[model samples]
Target: MDRSSDAPPHPAQALPVPAWQGTWRFTLPPIDSSVPQARHAIRDLLRRRAAPLSAERTHGLMLILSELVTNAVRHAALLTPEIGVEVTVDPHWAWVRVEDGHPYRPHALAASPERQRTGGRGLLLVQATAQEAGGSCGVRATAGGGKVIWAVLPLDRPTGRPATSPPPRSAP
Candidate 1:
């Protein structure tokens, strides 16, 4: 592949005009402390919105963000000192993306069952969580030689079912 400009594999998302387009952007140093702060920022954003997420949904979203950001801080800090986080939402779903300026390369994070307990399965957990909620998660390289990890999750429970409580049992 003839590469010219060092940019992300995916083109940057165009910021919608007026800035009220349900998008949240965050810039934070890739530090351990930023993890919690990032989560809080996202939580506050969701809370301020008109829609309310079930506790399960909120927790799941936080987990996805935490792992993605944590990985950047722990693994990519050598190349990138700052992390960029973005959240875009619609009626049905919220898309979260974490971008860092680390050099772009395939990240080997899978571990064998025996090794899994020791660690290195953050992405696996992230994928599982997103899948459980009928969403998707993935990574992509940026033009700046960094990469972005993203997850798309529903803002509400699946149709005809509740996330937590089962439908009220009908009187027998």
Candidate 2:
């Protein structure tokens, strides 16, 4: 009697995970130069990983990244020796977080046409940008007595494939 008929079939191979479906964290010196460097690094990372974000989404993410890093460098440099940046991109959303040793959790100011201002609008801009893209932004106090400001944007496109828009967002 042939015994080969009793053998089970081989299991199917699993699909390879995407390169961009994970978190990337790094620290940069709290200095003016780090602002542009952080932006370039993020742009390159998205390009290199072939993230599924549209061009406009990528640009907006970069802008949010820039403002966060710039704020850390300008305000937190006195107490923070290094600024930390973390980028997390899953299938549904892209998240950027900036952490600094300073404990201040800066609040985003509401834009007032009556009040003229040049500076102090970074957080406001970040909030507006994230909101426009169906995302949310907020600040949290870290365990080490620092603060982390984060923003997340949904990666849902209007066409081509099924939209996996993020769940309802909470207040920023």
RMSD of 2: 4.7
The residue-by-residue lDDT of candidate 1 on 1-172, one tens digit each, is: 8665566555455544332237879799978999999999998888777444687888999999999889888988888878999988654567788999876543446766657366677888887898898777777778887888888777673333333432121200
Model 1 regions lying over 4 Å from their true place: 1-21, 104-111, 157-172
Each model's lDDT comes to 0.75, 0.86
Best by lDDT: 2
Error of 1 at 78 (Å): 1.7
Candidate topping TM-score: 2
Tens-digit per-residue lDDT, 1-172, candidate 2: 9987687755664465688778999999999999999999999999899888899999989999999999999999998989999999877788999999999889987768986887899999998999898888888888999989999988754323544554444412
Off by over 4 Å in 2: 1-12, 156-172
